[model samples]
Target: MALGHRARAVIGSIAAAAALGALLTGCSTSSDEPAEAAEQAVEVDPALRAMLPGELLAESTRITVGTESGYPPFEYTNEAGRIVGFEIDLFDAASDRLGLKYTFHDMLFDSLLGELYASNVDVIAAAMSDTAERQADYDFVDYYNDSDAIMVPAGNPEGIKNLKDLCGRTVAVLTGSTQEEALAGLNAAECQDKPVEVVQFDTDADALAHVQEGKADAELTQWSTGAYNAKQVGSGDIFEVANTEIINPTPLGFVFLKGDVELVRAYQAAVQSIIDDGTYAEILKKHDLSAGAIEKATINNQPQG
Candidate 1:
């Protein structure tokens, strides 16, 4: 991606609502209890230490993880200015399992891959989808599954009930996202009369702002993110996820530099250890993201077409 072309910046309008509760459709996290029963810590396996790369084991005590702290419930800064979310919790469990320490750096989502390639960070934990295209540059330890949804202003004043409703209308989407590609496909297939006017923004927060301010008719984004953003921006008073067929189901993962096979293997093993020990499920449950939890800690094995 071009460093010069950044997505619209995430405005500070909704920064106060970063800690919105989970109320995503088709899922419920409000009633779920915390993953831990008490103050128990995840057990680390000494044997796993051998799996780490020589460079990692010999040089670094703490791994620096890159993340876009705008997406709530997955990874976002809380009121305390600390990044906290489901992804953070899962990383904590994985780190505990491998006896590793980590520090997270918040930056624009699109810049993460470049940062990783430049060795500015060790891994990316930005809820990034693991696609074949990305696998060409980096390896991913797949962790969760998610799909897309179209979100519009609350009450859906424009009556955008589904994807078809976006035909001939302007739609806001995050720049460089699969959502834009999906909408392009939709326009090519269905919007022959009037193609979808895709308004790309630098961040989900900005894309969300576009729709909320009536600059765009709706925004197409991940289902959970749409729901989370809706709850956060206006506490569900400004936007709501439209009733649309879930589209483009994708696997999200923690990304490592390509050819870093040993590091990938180490992280994969640590993730699997969490999954096997039930800490993975517990973390998802606590975040109300149990629905997106993967059954296994697979490598970049997801279908890319």
Candidate 2:
């Protein structure tokens, strides 16, 4: 981990979404619901607190968490450089349920798993997909549904509407992301002769910049991220999601090391606690991201017993 290159962002304002909600995918929020609901105090359960690892049981021990920002409506840095988003809010709510304290460490998306494996971060809060490839080595408490979208310049000059449209066209992707993997698979299986030219960047902002500057014809990212950028950046004149349809909506979660059963189960309970208390729904509703809301918390898609 590059200690010198990271910013420790104390994620705040989980419910301060009036401005944030306006820059979304046109989902409606309850104007009548006061922000006070989000600010409501969480009563920590002693049973759940007792389930935490001994090292984490201390009041002073802060769980080091890694997150890759720049994907808005999920995780991103504000103008003041504070990390705030739906994922941060969801996890914060979960932390409160478990009576745990944790801080978010923002870094390159590529370095998040590395930092987690190196013990520099105890968990990853980024909206990471719980793919079979990753589940082989990590246990993830599934929290939300995630899908990808194809974002192109406004008016979509390239006429890119779907994956087949990317043949021979340039697409910018965040390195180590599912989007990058999708491009690789496309090149190998479908676009061999005129392979889609893939440009990799370290963050979502950089990848989107490739399209904003006309370097790449399109950018592949989370559906919510693409939608938010389409609406917010350049006052809604910069980008547009070519594919309005959802693709491969998979469960995403807070990632933990494989065999870390206690930690994984503890979080599963925490997430369930929030779901039961309505905080989970409120967070998603505030962000207009209820499309990805889950009914129950799971680990790798299996209901926790």
TM-score winner among the candidates?
Answer: 2
The regions of model 1 sitting more than 4 angstroms off are: 1-40, 302-305
Model 1 clashing residue pairs (backbone): 7-202, 8-202
Q: What are the clash counts of all predictions, listed in order?
A: 2, 0
lDDT of each: 0.73, 0.77
Highest lDDT against the true fold, candidate: 2
TM-score of 2: 0.86
Q: Cα RMSDs of all predictions?
A: 9.2, 8.3
Q: Residues 36-107, candidate 2: write the lDDT tens digits.
A: 235656678889888876656777556667787777888876665567788878877788778877666667
TM-score of each: 0.82, 0.86
What lDDT does model 2 reach? 0.77
> Across residues 10-129, which tens digit of lDDT does each residue of candidate 1 receive?
112233112222211111111022432213468778777678754445423556677777787787766656667888788777776777766666666667787777665678887888
